[model samples]
Target: MFIDEAEIEVFAGRGGSGCLSFHREKFVPKGGPDGGDGGKGGDVVFVGDENLHTLMDSKYKKHYRAKNGSPGEGSNKTGKNGENAEIAVPLGTIFREDGKVIGEILSHGERFAAAAGGKGGRGNARFKSPTNRAPREFETGREGEKKLLKLELKLLADVGLVGFPNAGKSTLISVLSSAKPKIADYPFTTLIPNLGIVDCFNYRSFVIADIPGLIEGAHTGKGLGIQFIKHIERTSMLLFLIDMTEQNPKKAFDVLKGELKKFNPEILEKPMLIVLTKTDIDPDAKFPKRIGGIPVYPISSISRTGLEELKHYCCETVLRNN
Candidate 1:
């Protein structure tokens, strides 16, 4: 189950109460007051881990609470502090509180404090005065912080691959990376987006996301892109794949572009590449050199022709963009 969004509640531990006691000895009739201070409360923290790709764990567990602090003991013995609650999430996770984004974790081992613990109270010994020999007052512990959070995951990748269904997207990604996605001849074969790490020359590589296919009504939530388009918004570059054998390739490109524009015009502003797939079908066929102002490249994944050049170009383009 690939879950990208979740809601959870986090609470920090409460501080311990102060201790009050009077010193007593057999030899001395009246001994000064001897009391211990309370221990601190536990905090709730969130950490980013590269190993986690989905927010499925957060979806299953909706609430989290930290351990409470221990109370103080007599004879100036402080109580033990409570342990902290650590929550691990994937990179590119955004934390939102009350419909507004508070912070985001983008790197591995990144730590963010979701809620802070309460401070411990003071002991009666701290209240002792020179004028008053016996002062019987002590401070109380503070309450922990509590918050309701919304977690949203935007997949991190260097390049985003977008195309209509049956445009050879899965086949192309299979050749570019080790990811083995289910491929079919029909439309909408891929129900979920797949991330593949494309290895280029000299073992240099970058990440690519194969977003689900889009259709004419995709922008209106008629197809898969409505749910997967958010993934492409985070990418630095985009690859628009079109079928060369289609009756009119330019018209097909226009439809795809229109859908993307409707969703978010900013997406079209990114660095984009126009790719015509299935070039192996007609080696002698001629197509337009460019789509609008963007350069168009012809390639066939099965024949492996033009693939090497494409890989090197992708590597260079990503490096330049980075």
Candidate 2:
């Protein structure tokens, strides 16, 4: 399962306490006070790992904690420090604490401290003075820090493919890249977003993401709803595909536009390419030169019709924009 969101709690270790003792080595006179200082606590840290893409591991286990420090010993001996705890998450994951964003992990091996450990206490040996010799006093340790946090993951792709169910978007992605996504003749075959790397002319490469299909009332929670839309929010460009067998390509595009606009108005302003798929099934379908001032392309993944032109066009457009 592709779990994009999850909640967790982190706690740091507590500091150790101080110890006090009096020296009695059978000397001629009385001995002074001798005490040891306490050790410091551990910290809770979060790390980014590129191998992971989901927060499913955090879903089952919610809490993470560090170890507590040991107490101090007599004869000026300090306690052992606590061990630190490390949590690994995928890159492009955002961290939030109490509904406010703390920071985001954009690359692998990135580290962030979620909680800080408490400081150690003072020993009684340092409290000795000329006026009050052999005086005994010890301080207690401080408590550790704790926090509840939320994590959200966003996809990073150069191009995002958007269309209704059974529009041949998955088939096109399979042919374009080496990503092997499950394809079927029915609707909603893709439950999660799939990413693939497409290399174009002159060793130029880009990442593409194919999200779940959207329906007419997608913005209102119909047919995968906002879940699919959020996956494509970070794409540099969008490729909108329409089935060639459909009666009205303009209406299909309009519905997609309305849904995207309703969810996020900024999405409508991004550069987009209008394309018709499944040309092999309907060879006689009329191909329009332009729609709403945007160019149109008709392609067939099975027959590799117009596929090269489409790839080169996307590469050129993305390179120009970037």
Q: Write the per-residue lDDT of candidate 2 for residues 1-322, one digit (tens) a residue.
A: 1239999999999988877876668653677777777787888888989789888888888999988777777777887888888989997788899899897775578898888877767678778899878778888777889999999886577788989999988898999999899999999999988988889988887778888888899988998886657667656788899998888889899998888888788877778888899899978767888877778989999999988888888888777776
- In candidate 2, the residue pairs with backbone N, CA or C atoms under 3 Å apart (3 or more residues apart, or in different chains) clash, namely none
The whole-model lDDT of each prediction reads 0.84, 0.83
What lDDT would candidate 1 get against the real structure? 0.84
Q: Write the per-residue lDDT of candidate 1 for residues 92-208, one digit (tens) a residue.
A: 898999989898786678899888877777778778899866668776778889999999996577888889999988888899999898899999998888888898767678888
Clashing pairs in 1: none
- The residue ranges of model 1 lying beyond 4 angstroms of the native Cα positions read 1-9, 12-91, 94-155
* TM-score for candidate 2, residues paired by index: 0.59
